[model samples]
Target chain A: MAEHDSGGWTLERTIPSETAIGSELVSGLLAAMQEYAWPAAELFHVQLAYEEAIVNAIRHGNEFAADKTVQVRLSCTADEVRIEIADMGPGFDPDSLPDPRAEDRLEVPGGRGVMLIHELMSEVTYHPPGNRVTMIKRRPPSP
Target chain B: MAGFERLVVVDKEDISVVRFVDRKIIDASEIEQLGAELLSLVDIQQRKRLLLNFEGVEFLSSAALNKLITLHTRVKRAGGTVRICNLHPQIREVFAITRLDRMFEIASSESAGLAMF
Candidate 1:
């Protein structure tokens, strides 16, 4: 695991792909994030987004392989916060997923994590080969 | 980056309401802790009603929704009811996308939520 201090308002960490260990690792990273004076709502958004992304990495990206690892890096400034979750799994097309809002699929469960990430964060992008996802949320400027 | 507040209100009738007073964010671990607390309350009581007031929560993620489902299922199986009230437009969109809107009873106001019992 790798973590670094990008001056103030930013912290980053990396972890293995083990699902059980990944969850607790990300949870601790989120707890450290709370030390900053971020708005309570954004804090929750960040935590949830992190969980969804990291869990996906451990489960989908690495295919639950205990040998592989995932990388999570968080960067925050006075104006925004960005988190990049990268995994060793084969990347998939983000466009290929069926729309969760489609009338025919309204009753189906699961498949909302990606959509939720898009709604909560300002940006969500993916890189191929490595199956890495980078999510960003811009905090409103201080009054 | 909106401010967030959460409260657990217990009525004289033994009903417990968990209110999300502001936008729930990534830093709000208290919300999860609150869920565990609510579950414990259900374990101790045979029948109770839980009203989750989302008056100011503008957005919710899958993680948050999972916690809600966890609480709802636990409370319901224990002879309790969980109702959600005052979903912001964005939050409603989340519910619609996840189809959770169908799984839980949603109300526009606290009174409406309390009326579910």
Candidate 2:
């Protein structure tokens, strides 16, 4: 974890494939966002997207394997927040995911996490092998 | 009525008006428990109509949305229905982004949600 003179903070951690641990990390990020006075609605968006990404890493990427772990790095500045998450499991092709919004798929319960992450974040990119994902959310314009 | 740790359920006529006890429905275990409790409304208690009130809920994840979808599916299969109301603006935007706003009936007030049934 590192903090810079630019008033930005960065943190990197490798956590066990446990949702509780991920939640703790997220709580810390939320506190940092609050200290920076991130807008309330944007805070909700960050929380939702961050939670979804971490859960995907643990549940789908690692399959909750006891031997596997998830890597998370978060950086925040006055202008934007960036998050990257990677897992120890085999990667998947994001292109292969179905459109959750299809009329026929509306009733389906799963598969919305990836979509939500894409929509909520300002920008999203998936790395090679597909196990690593990076997301960015720019601060909304001041009212 | 059976007890629920995650929800507060009150029967209004034939509809079960349900409100969540947690402000943020993000925890994995808690989400699983919430799913089970909701399913019980149809499976065990035989509730035919449900109105989920999200008055104070400020945050929820895709996992929580999955539970609601599951409950909706079960209710439909049991010849019942589920309606949700009072979602915070951000939470409501989540539904819109996922297009779940098209999948579930959403109302601005409890009375409107109850009226949908």
Candidate 3:
């Protein structure tokens, strides 16, 4: 894990595909988000989105194999925070995934994670080979 | 008396209430254990009314939420009712965004949750 705050705030962390590490990583990201003065609601949304992405990378992309690594990057600008997660295993097509909110899909446990991420994040994009997902959260407009 | 690191299950007026102790993330381990415990509430103990109190919980992954869905399904299959209460606002928004709000009976407080059953 690398945390750099000299001129700009950045964090780059790499973890093996171990489910046990999921919470600790989420805590780290959330702590940074708080320190960056993220609004409480937006912070929570980012937290939710990031957790879904990281867990998906660890569980589905890497198949929970300890040999595989999931790389995460957190970078911040004045108005936005961006997160990128990449895993070692072959990835799946997000488009082909079922909608979790669909009446028939409600009972199925598999698709909600991605749905939550897409709903919470402002900009969500998947990279080539579908192994990495990037999410951006722009600060909400002033009330 | 299988104790969970993240949940405290207490009986109240014949209601099985599960309060999450973990303030932050409810990961896969917690979710797996929670799922098994909830299943037993119906499979072994034959509980008919349940309430999951999310008072202290701030952030939970889809894994944990999925487990809750499983618990809801099992309790329903057993002809029991599972109601949730005290969701932190953000978590409540998650339920709304994912449209899980329609699937489970949710209340703003414990008393209201218990009253549902």
**Order by TM-score, highest first:** 2, 3, 1
**lDDT (tens digit, per residue) of candidate 1 on B1-117:** 122235545563655666654464333365566555556656654436777788767555565666777777777677777788888766675676577887788888887888776
Q: Please state the error at residue B53 of candidate 1 in Å.
A: 8.7
Which tens-of-lDDT digit does each residue in A3-106 have in candidate 1? 44556444556677664555555554455456566676676667667777877787788887878888877766555678888898888787888877676754
lDDT of 3 by residue, B4-101 (tens): 56667899978989887778655677678777776777888798888999998887878878878888888888888888999999889888987889
Q: What proportion of the real contacts between chains A and B does each prediction keep? A: 0.23, 0.90, 0.77
Tens digits of per-residue lDDT for model 2 on A8-116? 8788899999998997787667777887889988888888889999999999999999999999999888789899999987888888999989999988889998999
Task: Specify the CAPRI tier of model 2.
Answer: high
Q: In model 1, which runs have C-alpha deviations exceeding 4 angstroms?
A: A1-6, A9-12, A26-36, B1-99, B108-111
Kindly give the stretch of ten consecutive residues in candidate 1 chain B with the minimal lDDT sum: B1-10
The lDDT values for all models are: 0.68, 0.90, 0.82
lDDT, residue A72, model 1: 73
Question: Candidates 2 and 3: which is better by TM-score?
Answer: 2
Model 3: lDDT to the true structure: 0.82
Candidate number achieving the greatest DockQ relative to the actual structure: 2
Q: Model 2, B77-98: lDDT tens per residue?
A: 9988889999999999999988
Q: Which candidate number would show the highest TM-score if scored against the true structure?
A: 2
Docking class of 3: medium
**Per-residue lDDT of candidate 3, residues A1-143 (tens digit):** 54646444677888888766754666666676677778889878887888788888887898988678999888765578889999997877889888888899887776788888888889999987899999999888888
